[model samples]
Target: MAFEVFKKSSAPVSTVPSVTIQKRGLISLNRAAYELIGSPEAVELLWDSDRRVVGLRATDLANPDAYPARPQSAQSNRGPILVAGSLFTRYIGLDTTEAKRWVPQVEDGILTLDLKVEGQPVSSNRRGTGESARETK
Candidate 1:
């Protein structure tokens, strides 16, 4: 059947003897005799990194009659959240100056602390800064 060729892979392309995608959809063939026509797109999309792939909404049907599978090297990562205030704000403003900081009250638990470059508190409350940054509410 005539499958709209997408980006060519590094592998070989299958050359069908004859194929057609018309109003009746894709049709498969055997050179001399057997020809079977399908009613829908020959290749079904299975999964995508984003909900909309190539700017068009795709489906979860990858292959017909195929079992659930996972692509090689597929993964998702969500880290932590770090609350930061502008440097212009007073450093003490981030300390126990208000009831907002739980670090001062709960020193035994996951209490946040001050971040200073040389000696001044930058008020950068971060955990594994680059690694963990997603906040969950």
Candidate 2:
């Protein structure tokens, strides 16, 4: 399942926006490469666009919203998208800001936000608040 990012309210939280829908039952990229072009004896290495040895990380490119992993040829409907994030943001404070911390919400509707207080370096335990609704101005 994939995660969804939603905006909390000081009054009351509401329905989440349909940004990136998650899917399960697909093979991972690693496994795909092994089946796609790997040898029958050894595992191969992969490089990024920069020609550097890439490592597993939490990035946006491998994410559903950014670049969701495609399903494998074998598993048609029950495959999971084992995605990874990419650190290729050209700007800072874009989504890692106080009012724009994008959290991952499971398909079951369980959201896990990596948020902190505004202007704080993720140290303050202010947590969050609940607002009514944005439509009620």
Which one is best on lDDT? 2
Write one digit per residue (lDDT tens) for candidate 1, span 39-90.
Answer: 1222221222232110111113465432222221235211211111222123
Model 1: how far residue 58 lies from native, Å = 40
| CA lDDT of each prediction against the hidden true structure | 0.21, 0.27
What's the distance in Å from true for residue 90, model 1? Answer: 2.8
TM-score of 1: 0.15
Q: Each prediction's Cα RMSD?
A: 28.2, 16.1
User: Tens-digit lDDT track for model 2 on 8-61?
Assistant: 332121232211211221113323232232212221112233322222222234
Model 2 misplacement above 4 A = 1-65, 72-74, 86-137
Give the Å error, residue 23, model 2: 19
Q: Under the 3 Å rule for N, CA and C atoms, how many clashes does model 1 have?
A: 3
